[model samples]
Target: MPAESQRLYERIAQKLANDISRGQYKIGQRLPSERELAQTFSVSRPTVREAIIALELDRLVEVRVGSGVYVTNTEPPGGKAGATDIGPFELLEARRSIEGEACALAATRIDDAQLAELNALLTEMRTENEKDVMLSEDADRRFHETIAAATQNSGMIAAVKMLWDARTRSPQSRSLSAKVRATGVKPRIDEHTAILKALRQRDPEGARAAMREHLTRVIDALLKATEVQELERARQQIAEQRKRYAASQ
Candidate 1:
Protein backbone atom coordinates (compact mmCIF):
# COMPACT_ATOMS: atom_id res chain seq x y z
CA MET A 1 0.00 0.00 0.00
CA PRO A 2 1.03 3.58 -0.55
CA ALA A 3 2.36 5.49 2.45
CA GLU A 4 -0.51 7.97 2.27
CA SER A 5 -3.10 5.17 2.27
CA GLN A 6 -1.47 3.51 5.26
CA ARG A 7 -1.46 6.74 7.17
CA LEU A 8 -5.07 7.51 6.31
CA TYR A 9 -6.27 4.12 7.53
CA GLU A 10 -4.19 4.43 10.66
CA ARG A 11 -5.88 7.71 11.40
CA ILE A 12 -9.33 6.23 10.83
CA ALA A 13 -8.45 3.28 13.03
CA GLN A 14 -7.38 5.55 15.85
CA LYS A 15 -10.57 7.57 15.57
CA LEU A 16 -12.68 4.42 15.73
CA ALA A 17 -10.68 3.21 18.71
CA ASN A 18 -11.27 6.46 20.55
CA ASP A 19 -14.95 6.17 19.78
CA ILE A 20 -15.08 2.59 21.00
CA SER A 21 -13.27 3.54 24.17
CA ARG A 22 -15.83 6.28 24.61
CA GLY A 23 -18.70 3.78 24.10
CA GLN A 24 -19.45 4.90 20.55
CA TYR A 25 -19.40 1.25 19.61
CA LYS A 26 -21.34 -0.69 22.18
CA ILE A 27 -19.67 -3.64 23.78
CA GLY A 28 -20.40 -7.03 22.16
CA GLN A 29 -21.83 -5.14 19.21
CA ARG A 30 -20.78 -5.50 15.58
CA LEU A 31 -19.17 -2.66 13.72
CA PRO A 32 -19.93 -1.80 10.09
CA SER A 33 -18.77 -4.33 7.50
CA GLU A 34 -15.64 -3.94 5.40
CA ARG A 35 -17.56 -2.73 2.35
CA GLU A 36 -19.51 -0.23 4.42
CA LEU A 37 -16.31 0.94 6.07
CA ALA A 38 -14.58 1.33 2.72
CA GLN A 39 -17.48 3.37 1.38
CA THR A 40 -17.86 5.44 4.52
CA PHE A 41 -14.17 6.21 4.84
CA SER A 42 -13.75 6.70 1.07
CA VAL A 43 -10.95 4.17 1.15
CA SER A 44 -10.39 0.77 -0.39
CA ARG A 45 -11.28 -2.53 1.27
CA PRO A 46 -7.61 -3.04 1.97
CA THR A 47 -7.52 0.19 3.87
CA VAL A 48 -10.45 -0.96 5.95
CA ARG A 49 -8.53 -4.16 6.58
CA GLU A 50 -5.58 -2.19 7.82
CA ALA A 51 -7.87 -0.14 10.02
CA ILE A 52 -9.43 -3.24 11.52
CA ILE A 53 -5.98 -4.68 12.19
CA ALA A 54 -5.06 -1.53 14.07
CA LEU A 55 -8.28 -1.61 16.08
CA GLU A 56 -7.62 -5.25 16.91
CA LEU A 57 -4.14 -4.42 18.12
CA ASP A 58 -5.68 -1.78 20.35
CA ARG A 59 -8.13 -4.39 21.73
CA LEU A 60 -11.02 -2.16 20.78
CA VAL A 61 -12.51 -4.86 18.59
CA GLU A 62 -12.12 -8.56 17.94
CA VAL A 63 -12.38 -9.93 14.39
CA ARG A 64 -14.42 -13.08 14.54
CA VAL A 65 -13.43 -14.89 11.35
CA GLY A 66 -16.26 -15.54 8.85
CA SER A 67 -18.50 -13.24 10.91
CA GLY A 68 -17.38 -9.66 11.49
CA VAL A 69 -15.63 -7.38 13.90
CA TYR A 70 -17.22 -7.01 17.34
CA VAL A 71 -16.55 -4.51 20.09
CA THR A 72 -14.43 -5.90 22.88
CA ASN A 73 -14.76 -5.27 26.59
CA THR A 74 -13.18 -2.05 27.76
CA GLU A 75 -14.29 -0.03 30.74
CA PRO A 76 -17.90 -0.16 31.93
CA PRO A 77 -18.48 -3.23 29.78
CA GLY A 78 -19.38 -6.76 30.89
CA GLY A 79 -16.85 -9.38 31.94
CA LYS A 80 -14.92 -11.97 29.93
CA ALA A 81 -15.84 -13.92 26.80
CA GLY A 82 -17.21 -16.92 28.68
CA ALA A 83 -20.42 -17.52 30.62
CA THR A 84 -19.01 -16.25 33.89
CA ASP A 85 -18.00 -13.08 32.07
CA ILE A 86 -15.35 -12.03 34.56
CA GLY A 87 -13.65 -9.56 32.21
CA PRO A 88 -11.37 -9.06 29.24
CA PHE A 89 -7.95 -10.59 28.71
CA GLU A 90 -6.51 -7.19 27.88
CA LEU A 91 -7.35 -5.97 31.38
CA LEU A 92 -5.47 -8.91 32.85
CA GLU A 93 -2.44 -8.18 30.68
CA ALA A 94 -2.59 -4.54 31.67
CA ARG A 95 -2.81 -5.37 35.34
CA ARG A 96 0.17 -7.69 35.08
CA SER A 97 2.17 -4.92 33.45
CA ILE A 98 1.27 -2.36 36.12
CA GLU A 99 0.97 -4.45 39.26
CA GLY A 100 4.39 -5.95 38.89
CA GLU A 101 5.71 -2.45 39.19
CA ALA A 102 3.38 -1.92 42.14
CA CYS A 103 5.08 -4.83 43.82
CA ALA A 104 8.41 -3.06 43.50
CA LEU A 105 6.84 0.11 44.77
CA ALA A 106 5.25 -1.73 47.65
CA ALA A 107 8.66 -3.10 48.50
CA THR A 108 9.82 0.46 49.05
CA ARG A 109 6.67 1.61 50.89
CA ILE A 110 5.77 -1.51 52.86
CA ASP A 111 5.39 -1.35 56.65
CA ASP A 112 5.08 -3.95 59.40
CA ALA A 113 1.28 -4.24 59.22
CA GLN A 114 1.21 -4.62 55.45
CA LEU A 115 3.86 -7.29 55.70
CA ALA A 116 1.79 -9.09 58.30
CA GLU A 117 -1.31 -9.09 56.08
CA LEU A 118 0.66 -10.46 53.15
CA ASN A 119 2.12 -13.16 55.33
CA ALA A 120 -1.31 -13.99 56.71
CA LEU A 121 -2.71 -14.48 53.26
CA LEU A 122 0.21 -16.69 52.29
CA THR A 123 -0.29 -18.77 55.38
CA GLU A 124 -3.96 -19.24 54.58
CA MET A 125 -3.06 -20.34 51.05
CA ARG A 126 -0.61 -22.94 52.33
CA THR A 127 -3.20 -24.78 54.38
CA GLU A 128 -5.84 -24.58 51.63
CA ASN A 129 -6.78 -27.95 50.17
CA GLU A 130 -6.38 -28.53 46.42
CA LYS A 131 -10.14 -29.11 45.99
CA ASP A 132 -11.03 -25.98 47.88
CA VAL A 133 -10.56 -23.82 44.82
CA MET A 134 -12.78 -20.95 45.85
CA LEU A 135 -11.02 -20.38 49.14
CA SER A 136 -7.61 -20.96 47.67
CA GLU A 137 -8.23 -18.64 44.75
CA ASP A 138 -9.65 -15.99 47.05
CA ALA A 139 -6.56 -16.18 49.22
CA ASP A 140 -4.33 -15.78 46.20
CA ARG A 141 -6.44 -12.87 45.09
CA ARG A 142 -6.20 -11.21 48.49
CA PHE A 143 -2.44 -11.51 48.46
CA HIS A 144 -2.18 -9.42 45.32
CA GLU A 145 -4.74 -6.99 46.66
CA THR A 146 -2.71 -6.62 49.82
CA ILE A 147 0.38 -6.01 47.75
CA ALA A 148 -1.50 -3.32 45.86
CA ALA A 149 -2.61 -1.80 49.13
CA ALA A 150 0.92 -1.79 50.41
CA THR A 151 1.93 0.43 47.49
CA GLN A 152 -0.24 3.28 48.86
CA ASN A 153 -1.35 4.08 45.35
CA SER A 154 -5.13 4.15 45.27
CA GLY A 155 -5.35 4.34 41.47
CA MET A 156 -3.08 1.37 41.01
CA ILE A 157 -5.02 -0.58 43.61
CA ALA A 158 -8.33 0.27 41.98
CA ALA A 159 -7.13 -0.71 38.51
CA VAL A 160 -5.76 -4.00 39.75
CA LYS A 161 -9.01 -4.70 41.59
CA MET A 162 -11.08 -4.15 38.46
CA LEU A 163 -9.00 -6.64 36.49
CA TRP A 164 -8.92 -9.20 39.27
CA ASP A 165 -12.63 -8.88 39.92
CA ALA A 166 -13.37 -9.35 36.25
CA ARG A 167 -11.10 -12.37 36.11
CA THR A 168 -12.69 -14.03 39.13
CA ARG A 169 -16.14 -13.73 37.55
CA SER A 170 -15.21 -15.40 34.25
CA PRO A 171 -16.17 -19.02 33.67
CA GLN A 172 -12.85 -19.59 31.99
CA SER A 173 -11.32 -18.11 35.12
CA ARG A 174 -11.48 -21.74 36.13
CA SER A 175 -8.56 -22.14 33.80
CA LEU A 176 -6.64 -19.74 36.02
CA SER A 177 -7.90 -20.93 39.38
CA ALA A 178 -7.47 -24.55 38.35
CA LYS A 179 -4.06 -23.83 36.91
CA VAL A 180 -3.16 -22.18 40.19
CA ARG A 181 -4.26 -25.22 42.10
CA ALA A 182 -2.61 -27.70 39.74
CA THR A 183 0.67 -26.01 38.91
CA GLY A 184 0.84 -24.71 42.43
CA VAL A 185 0.44 -28.24 43.78
CA LYS A 186 4.10 -28.28 44.70
CA PRO A 187 3.17 -25.51 47.12
CA ARG A 188 5.25 -22.42 46.55
CA ILE A 189 4.27 -21.56 50.12
CA ASP A 190 7.46 -19.62 50.34
CA GLU A 191 6.92 -17.65 47.14
CA HIS A 192 4.84 -14.85 48.63
CA THR A 193 6.84 -15.22 51.79
CA ALA A 194 10.02 -14.47 49.86
CA ILE A 195 8.40 -11.42 48.27
CA LEU A 196 7.09 -10.13 51.59
CA LYS A 197 10.51 -10.58 53.16
CA ALA A 198 12.12 -8.66 50.35
CA LEU A 199 9.49 -5.95 50.62
CA ARG A 200 10.01 -5.67 54.36
CA GLN A 201 13.70 -5.22 53.74
CA ARG A 202 12.87 -2.49 51.19
CA ASP A 203 14.67 -4.41 48.47
CA PRO A 204 12.96 -3.19 45.28
CA GLU A 205 15.12 -5.37 43.06
CA GLY A 206 14.30 -8.45 45.06
CA ALA A 207 10.59 -7.67 45.08
CA ARG A 208 10.56 -7.12 41.29
CA ALA A 209 12.44 -10.38 40.74
CA ALA A 210 9.99 -12.27 42.92
CA MET A 211 7.01 -10.75 41.10
CA ARG A 212 8.61 -11.59 37.73
CA GLU A 213 9.14 -15.21 38.69
CA HIS A 214 5.58 -15.58 39.96
CA LEU A 215 3.89 -13.94 36.97
CA THR A 216 6.21 -15.74 34.51
CA ARG A 217 4.59 -19.05 35.38
CA VAL A 218 1.17 -17.60 34.55
CA ILE A 219 2.35 -16.14 31.24
CA ASP A 220 4.03 -19.38 30.24
CA ALA A 221 0.97 -21.53 30.95
CA LEU A 222 -1.46 -19.21 29.17
CA LEU A 223 0.80 -19.11 26.11
CA LYS A 224 0.99 -22.88 25.97
CA ALA A 225 -2.78 -23.15 26.34
CA THR A 226 -3.38 -20.61 23.57
CA GLU A 227 -1.04 -22.57 21.26
CA VAL A 228 -2.85 -25.81 22.02
CA GLN A 229 -6.23 -24.23 21.40
CA GLU A 230 -5.06 -22.81 18.07
CA LEU A 231 -3.72 -26.20 16.96
CA GLU A 232 -7.00 -27.86 17.90
CA ARG A 233 -8.99 -25.26 15.95
CA ALA A 234 -6.82 -25.90 12.91
CA ARG A 235 -7.32 -29.63 13.20
CA GLN A 236 -11.07 -29.22 13.39
CA GLN A 237 -11.11 -27.02 10.31
CA ILE A 238 -9.07 -29.55 8.37
CA ALA A 239 -11.39 -32.35 9.41
CA GLU A 240 -14.42 -30.38 8.28
CA GLN A 241 -12.82 -29.60 4.94
CA ARG A 242 -12.00 -33.29 4.39
CA LYS A 243 -15.55 -34.31 5.19
CA ARG A 244 -16.98 -31.77 2.72
CA TYR A 245 -14.60 -33.03 0.00
CA ALA A 246 -15.67 -36.65 0.58
CA ALA A 247 -19.34 -35.65 0.38
CA SER A 248 -18.74 -33.78 -2.88
CA GLN A 249 -17.17 -36.90 -4.35
Candidate 2:
Protein backbone atom coordinates (compact mmCIF):
# COMPACT_ATOMS: atom_id res chain seq x y z
CA MET A 1 0.00 0.00 0.00
CA PRO A 2 1.06 3.57 -0.54
CA ALA A 3 2.46 5.62 2.33
CA GLU A 4 -0.52 7.96 2.33
CA SER A 5 -3.03 5.14 2.59
CA GLN A 6 -1.11 3.52 5.43
CA ARG A 7 -1.07 6.80 7.33
CA LEU A 8 -4.84 7.06 7.10
CA TYR A 9 -5.36 3.91 9.14
CA GLU A 10 -2.85 5.13 11.69
CA ARG A 11 -4.90 8.26 12.14
CA ILE A 12 -7.94 6.11 12.79
CA ALA A 13 -6.15 4.19 15.53
CA GLN A 14 -4.95 7.37 17.17
CA LYS A 15 -8.46 8.72 17.17
CA LEU A 16 -9.66 5.63 19.04
CA ALA A 17 -6.87 6.08 21.52
CA ASN A 18 -7.86 9.65 22.13
CA ASP A 19 -11.46 8.59 22.72
CA ILE A 20 -10.43 5.90 25.15
CA SER A 21 -8.22 8.21 27.22
CA ARG A 22 -10.93 10.82 27.45
CA GLY A 23 -13.30 8.20 28.90
CA GLN A 24 -15.71 7.99 26.00
CA TYR A 25 -15.12 4.24 26.15
CA LYS A 26 -14.32 3.27 29.70
CA ILE A 27 -12.32 0.30 30.89
CA GLY A 28 -13.94 -3.06 30.19
CA GLN A 29 -16.70 -1.36 28.27
CA ARG A 30 -17.69 -2.51 24.84
CA LEU A 31 -16.59 -0.13 22.18
CA PRO A 32 -19.02 0.78 19.42
CA SER A 33 -19.54 -1.91 16.81
CA GLU A 34 -17.22 -1.88 13.82
CA ARG A 35 -19.97 -0.93 11.42
CA GLU A 36 -21.10 1.86 13.72
CA LEU A 37 -17.59 3.21 14.06
CA ALA A 38 -17.03 3.00 10.30
CA GLN A 39 -20.22 4.94 9.72
CA THR A 40 -19.37 7.50 12.35
CA PHE A 41 -15.86 8.05 11.04
CA SER A 42 -16.86 7.80 7.37
CA VAL A 43 -14.29 5.10 6.84
CA SER A 44 -14.52 1.48 5.70
CA ARG A 45 -14.94 -1.64 7.83
CA PRO A 46 -11.46 -2.83 6.93
CA THR A 47 -10.02 0.48 8.01
CA VAL A 48 -11.93 0.34 11.26
CA ARG A 49 -10.63 -3.17 11.87
CA GLU A 50 -7.09 -1.97 11.35
CA ALA A 51 -7.61 0.67 14.01
CA ILE A 52 -8.98 -1.89 16.45
CA ILE A 53 -5.89 -3.97 15.86
CA ALA A 54 -3.73 -1.01 16.73
CA LEU A 55 -5.67 -0.55 19.93
CA GLU A 56 -5.20 -4.20 20.81
CA LEU A 57 -1.48 -3.88 20.18
CA ASP A 58 -1.40 -0.97 22.54
CA ARG A 59 -3.48 -2.94 25.05
CA LEU A 60 -6.00 -0.15 24.97
CA VAL A 61 -8.68 -2.55 23.81
CA GLU A 62 -9.19 -6.25 23.31
CA VAL A 63 -11.02 -7.93 20.42
CA ARG A 64 -12.88 -11.13 21.11
CA VAL A 65 -14.23 -13.30 18.36
CA GLY A 66 -18.02 -13.74 18.29
CA SER A 67 -18.36 -10.73 20.60
CA GLY A 68 -16.69 -7.38 19.87
CA VAL A 69 -13.91 -5.10 20.90
CA TYR A 70 -13.75 -4.05 24.56
CA VAL A 71 -11.67 -1.44 26.31
CA THR A 72 -8.83 -2.86 28.36
CA ASN A 73 -8.43 -2.15 32.05
CA THR A 74 -5.04 -0.69 31.51
CA GLU A 75 -3.34 2.41 30.22
CA PRO A 76 -2.17 2.64 26.63
CA PRO A 77 1.05 0.79 25.82
CA GLY A 78 4.09 1.97 27.80
CA GLY A 79 1.74 4.46 29.47
CA LYS A 80 2.32 6.79 26.55
CA ALA A 81 -0.28 8.76 24.69
CA GLY A 82 -1.47 7.46 21.35
CA ALA A 83 0.74 8.50 18.50
CA THR A 84 -2.27 9.86 16.65
CA ASP A 85 -3.47 12.03 19.54
CA ILE A 86 -3.72 15.60 18.24
CA GLY A 87 -5.12 18.89 19.47
CA PRO A 88 -8.35 20.20 17.96
CA PHE A 89 -6.48 23.04 16.33
CA GLU A 90 -4.08 20.54 14.78
CA LEU A 91 -6.98 18.59 13.34
CA LEU A 92 -8.46 21.77 11.84
CA GLU A 93 -5.07 22.65 10.39
CA ALA A 94 -4.95 19.29 8.63
CA ARG A 95 -8.43 19.85 7.27
CA ARG A 96 -7.50 23.30 6.10
CA SER A 97 -4.60 21.87 4.12
CA ILE A 98 -6.47 18.98 2.47
CA GLU A 99 -9.98 20.38 2.11
CA GLY A 100 -8.77 23.72 0.82
CA GLU A 101 -7.06 21.98 -2.05
CA ALA A 102 -10.09 19.79 -2.64
CA CYS A 103 -12.32 22.85 -2.68
CA ALA A 104 -10.07 24.51 -5.23
CA LEU A 105 -10.15 21.45 -7.46
CA ALA A 106 -13.91 21.15 -7.11
CA ALA A 107 -14.27 24.69 -8.41
CA THR A 108 -12.92 23.71 -11.82
CA ARG A 109 -14.61 20.32 -12.13
CA ILE A 110 -17.93 20.71 -10.30
CA ASP A 111 -20.91 20.49 -12.63
CA ASP A 112 -24.06 22.54 -12.42
CA ALA A 113 -25.93 19.56 -11.03
CA GLN A 114 -23.38 19.01 -8.28
CA LEU A 115 -23.47 22.69 -7.46
CA ALA A 116 -27.25 22.51 -7.18
CA GLU A 117 -27.03 19.51 -4.89
CA LEU A 118 -24.59 21.37 -2.63
CA ASN A 119 -26.89 24.39 -2.53
CA ALA A 120 -29.82 22.20 -1.54
CA LEU A 121 -27.84 20.62 1.27
CA LEU A 122 -26.74 24.03 2.54
CA THR A 123 -30.34 25.22 2.44
CA GLU A 124 -31.38 22.20 4.47
CA MET A 125 -28.70 23.03 7.03
CA ARG A 126 -29.86 26.65 7.17
CA THR A 127 -33.47 25.63 7.69
CA GLU A 128 -32.49 23.31 10.47
CA ASN A 129 -30.49 26.08 12.10
CA GLU A 130 -33.30 28.59 11.77
CA LYS A 131 -35.68 26.26 13.56
CA ASP A 132 -33.19 26.06 16.45
CA VAL A 133 -33.12 22.32 15.96
CA MET A 134 -29.97 20.46 16.79
CA LEU A 135 -28.40 20.44 13.37
CA SER A 136 -27.08 17.07 12.32
CA GLU A 137 -23.53 16.95 11.09
CA ASP A 138 -24.60 14.52 8.37
CA ALA A 139 -25.59 17.29 6.02
CA ASP A 140 -22.36 19.05 6.78
CA ARG A 141 -20.41 15.88 5.94
CA ARG A 142 -22.31 15.38 2.72
CA PHE A 143 -21.61 18.93 1.61
CA HIS A 144 -17.86 18.40 1.96
CA GLU A 145 -18.04 14.91 0.46
CA THR A 146 -19.78 16.34 -2.58
CA ILE A 147 -16.96 18.77 -3.05
CA ALA A 148 -14.41 15.97 -2.79
CA ALA A 149 -16.33 13.95 -5.35
CA ALA A 150 -16.30 16.89 -7.70
CA THR A 151 -12.52 16.95 -7.49
CA GLN A 152 -12.61 13.58 -9.29
CA ASN A 153 -9.54 12.42 -7.42
CA SER A 154 -9.90 9.20 -5.47
CA GLY A 155 -6.87 10.00 -3.32
CA MET A 156 -8.16 13.42 -2.49
CA ILE A 157 -11.55 12.00 -1.54
CA ALA A 158 -9.94 9.44 0.75
CA ALA A 159 -7.72 12.04 2.35
CA VAL A 160 -10.64 14.33 3.06
CA LYS A 161 -12.63 11.44 4.55
CA MET A 162 -9.71 10.46 6.78
CA LEU A 163 -9.39 13.97 8.16
CA TRP A 164 -13.11 14.10 8.91
CA ASP A 165 -12.94 10.70 10.55
CA ALA A 166 -10.20 11.95 12.82
CA ARG A 167 -12.39 14.83 13.89
CA THR A 168 -15.37 12.66 14.79
CA ARG A 169 -13.29 9.98 16.49
CA SER A 170 -10.72 12.06 18.35
CA PRO A 171 -11.62 12.78 21.97
CA GLN A 172 -10.09 16.23 21.95
CA SER A 173 -11.97 17.15 18.81
CA ARG A 174 -15.28 15.81 20.11
CA SER A 175 -14.90 17.51 23.52
CA LEU A 176 -14.10 20.83 21.88
CA SER A 177 -17.11 20.42 19.59
CA ALA A 178 -19.33 19.71 22.58
CA LYS A 179 -18.12 22.88 24.25
CA VAL A 180 -18.77 24.92 21.13
CA ARG A 181 -22.24 23.49 20.77
CA ALA A 182 -23.03 24.02 24.45
CA THR A 183 -22.07 27.63 23.88
CA GLY A 184 -24.69 27.67 21.09
CA VAL A 185 -22.27 27.87 18.20
CA LYS A 186 -23.93 26.40 15.16
CA PRO A 187 -22.69 25.95 11.63
CA ARG A 188 -22.05 29.16 9.74
CA ILE A 189 -24.61 29.08 6.95
CA ASP A 190 -23.38 32.26 5.29
CA GLU A 191 -19.78 31.11 5.38
CA HIS A 192 -20.78 27.92 3.59
CA THR A 193 -22.79 29.98 1.12
CA ALA A 194 -19.68 31.95 0.31
CA ILE A 195 -17.78 28.76 -0.37
CA LEU A 196 -20.57 27.56 -2.66
CA LYS A 197 -20.55 30.88 -4.47
CA ALA A 198 -16.84 30.58 -5.08
CA LEU A 199 -17.32 27.13 -6.53
CA ARG A 200 -20.23 28.30 -8.67
CA GLN A 201 -18.00 30.94 -10.21
CA ARG A 202 -15.31 28.27 -10.85
CA ASP A 203 -12.74 30.39 -9.06
CA PRO A 204 -10.17 27.96 -7.69
CA GLU A 205 -8.27 30.51 -5.66
CA GLY A 206 -11.45 31.95 -4.27
CA ALA A 207 -12.73 28.52 -3.37
CA ARG A 208 -9.45 27.75 -1.64
CA ALA A 209 -9.57 31.03 0.26
CA ALA A 210 -13.14 30.50 1.37
CA MET A 211 -12.45 26.98 2.62
CA ARG A 212 -9.35 28.09 4.49
CA GLU A 213 -11.22 30.95 6.08
CA HIS A 214 -14.00 28.62 7.15
CA LEU A 215 -11.60 26.27 8.90
CA THR A 216 -9.80 29.25 10.41
CA ARG A 217 -13.08 30.31 11.96
CA VAL A 218 -13.44 26.84 13.39
CA ILE A 219 -9.99 27.12 14.95
CA ASP A 220 -10.93 30.42 16.50
CA ALA A 221 -14.17 28.97 17.82
CA LEU A 222 -12.39 26.02 19.37
CA LEU A 223 -9.98 28.35 21.18
CA LYS A 224 -12.80 30.46 22.50
CA ALA A 225 -14.76 27.42 23.56
CA THR A 226 -11.83 26.09 25.56
CA GLU A 227 -11.49 29.40 27.32
CA VAL A 228 -15.18 29.48 28.12
CA GLN A 229 -15.03 26.01 29.62
CA GLU A 230 -12.05 26.94 31.76
CA LEU A 231 -13.75 30.09 32.96
CA GLU A 232 -16.88 28.20 33.93
CA ARG A 233 -14.82 25.63 35.78
CA ALA A 234 -13.06 28.37 37.71
CA ARG A 235 -16.36 29.96 38.65
CA GLN A 236 -17.65 26.66 40.00
CA GLN A 237 -14.52 26.22 42.06
CA ILE A 238 -14.86 29.69 43.47
CA ALA A 239 -18.50 29.15 44.30
CA GLU A 240 -17.66 25.99 46.18
CA GLN A 241 -15.01 27.84 48.20
CA ARG A 242 -17.46 30.63 49.01
CA LYS A 243 -20.02 28.14 50.29
CA ARG A 244 -17.38 26.53 52.51
CA TYR A 245 -16.34 29.91 53.95
CA ALA A 246 -19.96 30.84 54.72
CA ALA A 247 -20.43 27.53 56.50
CA SER A 248 -17.45 28.36 58.74
CA GLN A 249 -18.96 31.80 59.49
The candidate scoring highest on TM-score is: 2
The clash count for each model shown is 4, 0
Q: Give per-residue CA lDDT, model 2, range 1-249, as digits (tens).
A: 344754555778777877888888889898877777889889866456556655765678876544568898456768764445444565677889999999999999999999999999998888877665345466888889999999999999999888888877876566556656777787888889999999999999999999999989977765554441113345688999999999999
Off by over 4 Å in 2: 1-84, 131-134, 228-249
User: What C-alpha lDDT values do all the predictions have?
Assistant: 0.67, 0.77
**Model 1, residue pairs in steric clash:** 80-85, 80-87, 86-166, 86-170
The C-alpha TM-scores of every prediction are: 0.52, 0.59
Can you give the lDDT of residue 217 in candidate 2? Answer: 91
The lDDT, on a scale of 0 to 1, for candidate 1 is 0.67
Tens digits of lDDT, candidate 1, 1-249? 344644565667766766777888898988877777778888766456546655654566776644678898553233221121322334355666777788999988888988888888887887784456567667888988988888899988998798787776544444434544543443356667777777888998888888767766555554333221123456688999999999999
Q: What lDDT is reached at residue 186 by model 2?
A: 77
